[model samples]
Target: MPQATKSKDGCINQLKIAENHLSGNYQEKRESYDKEEQLMIYLSKGHSPNDKYESYDEILMPIGALLNNTLNYQEKNEVIKEYGLDDEEFKERMRDMCNLGEALELEARQEESKRKDVEHVRNIIDEFHCSLEKAMDILKLTEKERQEIMPYFQA
Candidate 1:
């Protein structure tokens, strides 16, 4: 729904299939699903990291023909579906959904806000710790006893 930013391995596998078909060098075997999945996480949206079907089918068709002519329309459909986009309309649907630049700015703002709050929080912790130390000095709480009661700070 949210432009499906996460990598879909099936889609990348389809890309790998395309690559093998194009190069005729099958030495570049498929990666394990987990490795593929991890790699996908690192790619920009839509660019499959390991392997990907070409963005265009005219490009894909030639490759498809080379791969034993094994154009299993159903399997392709399934991979396309997992991506939530068809070869016909994938790019259009992906458009305008994610603004990476704006997202980075927003993330920076949110982090800045969070950092400000955390600074205050750390100050409070420092204050409390200081106060606790002073109180402990007053009460002379032993180190073992202080550790046991650390959770009381949250309240």
Candidate 2:
């Protein structure tokens, strides 16, 4: 028999519990029915498990802990210490991950802003039945903005 039953609701409930714990909204202690569940609970609380991971999913626990926004630097360091990782190396890797995440978020925002600008320009062209340059001129778009949206018009 499987040690723990897998269900959508169960997974969601577990996630909610973890989120609550991270947010300081849940303070009650819960029992772990199995080793896998225990490991998950520990990971959620930034506590490292004693046993080595036996599967790919288990291996991702530390990564998840590292990426968790609610876990402070000290908590993350504790996780690294428990996992027996090199302190400096793990801290550097964590910094890289943080920088990458921030970069991706900034890129996404820029793309969205550009998309909206393109849509506005298209709307202007449709409303005025004008050329692209004329529509951009009416909108008073800067040279950089016009250049950024030019590729959308070309395609």
Candidate 3:
């Protein structure tokens, strides 16, 4: 079975319990569940199947604890059964999820770097009071790269 379907159901089933535990739904609190679910779905879709979990109880424990604490033991067991991964399989899935997190963080870092580069160029234009062409030349940006960053600088 696809992880997304299982995770979506798991999230929908467990979110209410988590929310209830956290108490009165403030904006950030309410948004966390949606954000978490979206992240799970995004990771599930991106994860490669070949990745295996080697960490045993270390990696899986937090997941099991979250389920057990929020959803309760009986519900947690039922959910595990419904998802149908045995111990080894469940571990592998957990590892894949961890990889998804690493992948997302890497992507975010790369994007942040690109954003900084754009800001540097924008700063050159504003603080130095230079034209875009001059800024591009000063930054040593290729025409294509300059064009790509131009949309962010529109008046």
Candidate 4:
């Protein structure tokens, strides 16, 4: 048996294929299929050309159902129910996912602030031809901030 495609590219490709197929572009009849049919078509597209995704149906079906914007709240709940997934478990997982996203956003913002601080220090040094300490002092950076950016100057 062929291994299932677990890469991000595979998942993205499958979504696109499903979207096109359900939009009536891939079939002779448009909007003739139900939500379940749409999901099967999406899961069938997997990664490899010949990938039947025998093992991924369960894993991918819920994701497909959730991501399909055409499905309303009741439809999504129905589809999810068919997979034997618990409502409370799914809700908990969604909360976890949201927390992870917020954490990642915070980290990214902190990194951007650090980069801007370094850039400001570099600009001050170049414009005034002063030492790192003098440039940092001109910017009124705190001791902790200076220490944080010190390695960047060394690099």
Worst 10 residues of 3 by lDDT: 38-47
lDDT of 4 by residue, 21-120 (tens): 4453454554654442322233222343222335566666666555544444555566667778757988566445545656777999988988988999
The alpha-carbon lDDT assigned to residue 155 of candidate 1 equals 72
* Deviation in Å, model 1, residue 63 alpha carbon: 21
In the range 1-155, model 2's lDDT, one tens digit per residue, is: 11223221112123222323456565655555233232232234332333344454344445645666555566656666666774787788877776676788799999998899999999999998999999899889899999999999995
**Per-candidate TM-score against the hidden true structure:** 0.23, 0.52, 0.41, 0.46
TM-score, predicted candidate 1 vs. hidden true structure: 0.23
The 10 consecutive residues of candidate 4 with the worst lDDT sum are: 36-45
Query: If both were scored by lDDT, which would come out higher, candidate 1 or candidate 2?
Result: 2
**Candidate 3 on 1-155: residue-level lDDT in tens?**
12344243223222223444566655555655654432231123322223323343333433443232223334444444544544766656655555565677799997796787798888998999998888889988877777778888788
lDDT of 1 by residue, 49-86 (tens): 23554464433322232221122344444444555456
Candidate 4: Cα lDDT at 111:
86
Clashes of each: 2, 0, 0, 0
Tell me the lDDT of candidate 3: 0.53
